[model samples]
Target: MDQTEKNVQTLFSMGFLDIEDIKNALRISHNDLSEAVAILTNDQVRYGPYSSAGPAEDVEMKDVTSTALVPTAAPPPYNSLPDAKPCSPKPDYGNTAFPQTNLYELEQRVFVDQWSIPYKKDESLAKCLIAATSLAKEGNHP
Candidate 1:
């Protein structure tokens, strides 16, 4: 039902006195389970008359049922590859002009492959080179 009823039921199930005793404790302790427990324990009324007999038999039955469902076999071992090696850490290339140089080299290679442009024609390649350089500087690529 309500919170106080739940607290009374919990206290009753925890082997902590009878339903009447738990209710009285809950009432005296403002429905706080911890305070009610403390009150019951202080009065030397921790366990109910039927608590010892009922719970012990129930616990034994639960243990029997749980053990029956458990598997007795040992688990298999894990296999790992012999040739697997951890990768080396990458080198930090701090703010340098290496990327711009690499971009120029890649653009030259692409121009040579796609347009069949001879290496001697500087004037004709200048326009395409300028556009490629601008795009590479702006962190954009075709």
Candidate 2:
């Protein structure tokens, strides 16, 4: 219904924590959805220790490493490798021959046969015969 409600629902659907935990995260993160998600995900909640209901069960929590949060090392520069040529070799376009014929003339010749409509019998005579037969059957004509 509202933006805050939608954000809360989104955080709930992420399957990380409960609604109360999500609300606490949203308050701590100043209603910023991204920050709220990051806080919940990074396990930086300051309200209180999160305790699951019932007896202690073996619930596996995924290890979040700092490297996973932020990339530690930048990728090696592209040009640092040996055998890397400076500027891609100029594309070879030497004396490439192309057809010089007019495209419109070629298209007209290619489609001349397809452009003509083919008829196996006289179209007007067929229509007239069909109309006459229908009229006779309906007793509207002798």
TM-score of each predicted structure versus truth: 0.30, 0.30
Mind giving the per-residue lDDT tens digits that candidate 1 earns over 1-142? 9998899789988998678778877766678888778767753354344332234232111134545555545322111223222322432233323344434443554554232222322222343455456667878764
Error of 2 at 77 (Å): 28
Q: Global lDDT for candidate 2?
A: 0.49
Candidate 2 per-residue C-alpha lDDT over 1-142 given as tens digits, one digit per residue, 9 for 90 to 100: 9777888999988885588768766766668888777767764353223633123433234555644554456433434534222432332223222212222322433364333221113222233344455556667653
In angstroms, the error of model 2 at 90 is 30
lDDT: worst 10-residue window of model 1: 75-84
Per-model root-mean-square deviation over C-alphas:
24.8, 27.1
Model 2 misses residue 42 by how many Å? 2.3
In candidate 1, which residue pairs get closer than 3 Å at backbone N, Cα or C atoms, i.e. clash?
none
Scored by CA lDDT, what does every candidate get?
A: 0.51, 0.49
34: Cα error in model 2, Å: 1.0
